[model samples]
Each structure stands twice: as structure tokens, then as C-alpha cells.
Target: MKDHLSALVQKANLGDREALEQVLLKIKDLVYNLSLKMLLFPEDAKDATQEILIKVVTHLSTFNHKSQFKTWVYRIATNYLLNHKGKRSKEFAMPFKDYTDLIDLGHSNEVRYTKNEGELSLLEEEVKVSCTQGLLLCLNEIDRMVYILTDILGFNGVEGSEILGISSENYRQKLSRSRAKVRSFLNNKCGLVNPENPCRCTKKIDFLIDQKIVNPKDLRFAHFSDRSIDLVGRIDDLEKSVAIYRSTPNFPAPEELLEEIKTTLKIN
Candidate 1:
């Protein structure tokens, strides 16, 4: 597969439009999902995915094959996301203290349970995905990328270090600290992680709907499918905290975005 992808890269660099499209197709989901996790918004992720792919195509000739093609792609995606200062990133740059305060705003505001089983399921899934992304935003960009690459996406230490351009020791230390922070937050506040917590998804459904934060009619992150990171990748031993994220859906890139990217590049 690596050899095949390298051939695609070579063809793409030689201005073969079909090979360029094929290469983009291969890595589109990876770039999009990483952008989604980093930006926490589907629209923003789609835009960032397009930008990253353009960069990938522009730099196609520079790939030295010293590492796997996927790793090189990951390195590019992570570097873009790490330095990304989009509108959403600015709004989401709060520390845990601010995040806790936001959660506490709704902590005692649970409305009455009032939705059918179908709607309840969808809304709960939305809350889970949204809440998980919110929790990740509490971490700094580097630590967040480390946790996502190592824990959620199941990249090992060496791969994570390579993707982030950091030493394996530094990657491991960041992973350890990031995991502890997320675990601690989940233990204290997330009802899914600890039944003792009061922040149930069911309790937030009506409030989210009323506030236009989440719409049952237009579900964003919650798809009615069984696909998750579990089916798509490895998660090491699946520690409890990481398990919370691994169970969430592996979101796909927008259906029309790939064609748009090709058109933008003027690929015939």
C-alpha cells in the first residue's frame, strides 16, 4: 500500500490529474477527521481539509519517503492544525477553568425529559460527540493533538512523535498528562464517565434544542450508524478515558468537498 501510494504521489507530482485526485481521495478522510477534531466544527473542518489538501498537492515532490506516506500526511495535517487560528479555535481556546464554568452554567439547568426514544437517541449522540470535542478543547493544541493521535486514533508513541515532530519521550509525557487531565475532567463532570455526575445528555437535549445549539431536525455530528473509531482503527488497550472517545463516530468528509477540491486545483 505504501508503494502504491508513493507511485500515486509520483504521478501526481508529474501533473497526472487522475493520480492527484486518487491521492486526495486516499487521504481526504484522514485530513478531514483530524481537522474536525481540531476545529470542532464540521464546516470549519471541511474548509481546513481543502486547504490542507492543496498544501499536500503543492508539496507532493518534497516527500522524501523517509517515513510512510500516511505519516507524512499526518505531519502536514497536524502542523496546519497546531498553528490554525480560525474563528472557532479562538472561541474554543479556553482553559479547563473556563470550560468548567461553561458546563456549570448548565449544571443546574436540566429541563424536564421530553423527547421520543428516536429523538432522544439522536440528541444524546449529538451531545456525546459535542461534549467530547469540548473536553478536548480544554487542552492546549499540542497536548490535544498528542492525545488524539496516540489515544483516539491509536497511533503508537514513535508514530505520534514523528507526526508531531517531537521526540518520543516528549510525546509520551504529553500523552500521559493530557490523558490524566481529560480523565479527571470526565470523572468529575461527565455523567457518561461517572454516574455520580449530574450532566446527563438526556438532561441537555431540550435545552440544546431550545437554544439552537443542537437541532434534532438537523443532526450534525450524530449519524444514525454503527461506525466508530473502534471499527476503523486500533486504540491500544483502550483505557477508560480513551474508551469514551473511541466509541464516538468516525466522521467522514463532506460528500461534495472532494470534487470541489479537485476543481479548485483545476484538476481535469
Candidate 2:
């Protein structure tokens, strides 16, 4: 698979459009789901997913096979969503160890539940979506990525770390904290628990359990190797697809993306 991906990337570099298409097709679901998580709307997720493909088609020649294609694509998606959010979307970004590590956590106010007469009045369906997005907002960006990759996307810690640019150790810790926060917030909002102060996350354990439950690792890990370097290639492939599709608002020919792929080689 490494040799095949390497060759595919090389072909893409040489402007073999077919090779690029092959690569993009492989990760379409990943791109779309990631966009949905990032944008929190079906329309926006669809648009971003399509745009990510287009970007990959145009810029395949420039992708340098670094930082796991998935991570690279996510980074692009994250940046676009953060800096140029769509109409009606929130703009919640977080500062990081690397300012370049900016992530679209979405603004605090966007889609936040309306407490009408003291109760969140979203319809049954909207409630799930709203609560999910609200829960996502509470997490710091990296933690959010880890949560989505594992919880929503199913990636393992080793692979997830590559996508989010964090250590496995940190990923575990962040995931732990994020899950606790999300579960706590959900328990309160769902009327399962009170939100007055020091949270009681006890029932969450049983809830997670009754669900056939989890300590769900970041959900997107089917293809990742146990190692980080391998994860970089996966992310590199992923980034190419994302850059083309799931932008925040306006999908521009990005500048930061050029640097993301190049950095992977330095690590390799």
C-alpha cells in the first residue's frame, strides 16, 4: 500500500489526473464526514466535500506526501472553516502550540441552544444535531479533532495523533477529558443530570456501557499503521482531498497548505 500510495502521489505530482482521482475516490467518505463534523451542517458538509475533491484535482501536483494525507486534508479543512466560515456558521478558533495549528472549533454562539422559557426548544431531530455541535464547541480544537476522528470517524490513537499533530499520550489525555466534558454536558442538557456545578459523570459510564459502550478511540483509524510516520502518509492523501472540498465559506487556493505537505518530508 505504501509503494502504491507513493507511486500514486508521484503520479499526481507529475499531473496524472487519473492517479489523483484514484486517491481522492479512496477517501471521499472521510473527507465528507470530517467536513460535516467541522461544519456541522449537511449542506455545508456536502459543499466542502465536493470542494475538497476539486482542490485535490487541481493541486495534486503540489502535495508532498507528508503529515498523513488525512491530517493534511483536515488541517486545510480546519483552517478554511476557521478563517472563512460560511454564512450563519460560527467562527470558533483556538490558539495552539503552533499558531499554524489553528483549528475551527466554531464560535460559541453559533447554533447554541436557545433557552426559551427555560428549556432548549429544538425539535427532536434538531436536538441531537444541536447538542452534538454544542458538545464539539466545548472541546479545544485538537481534542475535538481527536474526538471526531475516534468517536465519529473511528481512528485509533496512533493514527489520530498524526491527524491532529499530537502525541499518542496527549491524544489519550485529550480524548479522555473531551469525552468527560461532552458526556457531562450531554447529561445535563439531556436532562439526565443537573448542571449547577461540579459535574456528576457517573451515569455516563452506565450510559456509555448500555450502548455497548465505549472508551471509543478517535473513530477514523481503519487504515492507520501503529506508527506516526505511516499516519502522515495517510493524512497527506487525506489533505489533498479535503483542500479541494470542505472549506469554511469561500474555498480559495490556500497558502498554508503548501507548507503543510512540505513539512512532512522534514519529519520523514
Stretch of 10 with least lDDT, candidate 2:
240-249
Regions of model 1 farther than 4 Å from truth: 107-114, 224-237
State the lDDT of candidate 1 residue by residue for 87-156, as single tens digits.
7666766889887766665533444544467656666778777777877888988999998997889899
RMSD of each: 3.1, 15.2
Residue-wise C-alpha lDDT for candidate 2, range 42-135, written one tens digit per residue: 4566666666655655555666776556566665555554444434334433232221121121213222233352222212222223333534
Candidate 2 achieves a global lDDT of: 0.47
The candidate maximizing lDDT is 1
List candidate 2 segments past 4 Å from native: 1-8, 50-59, 62-84, 91-126, 191-268
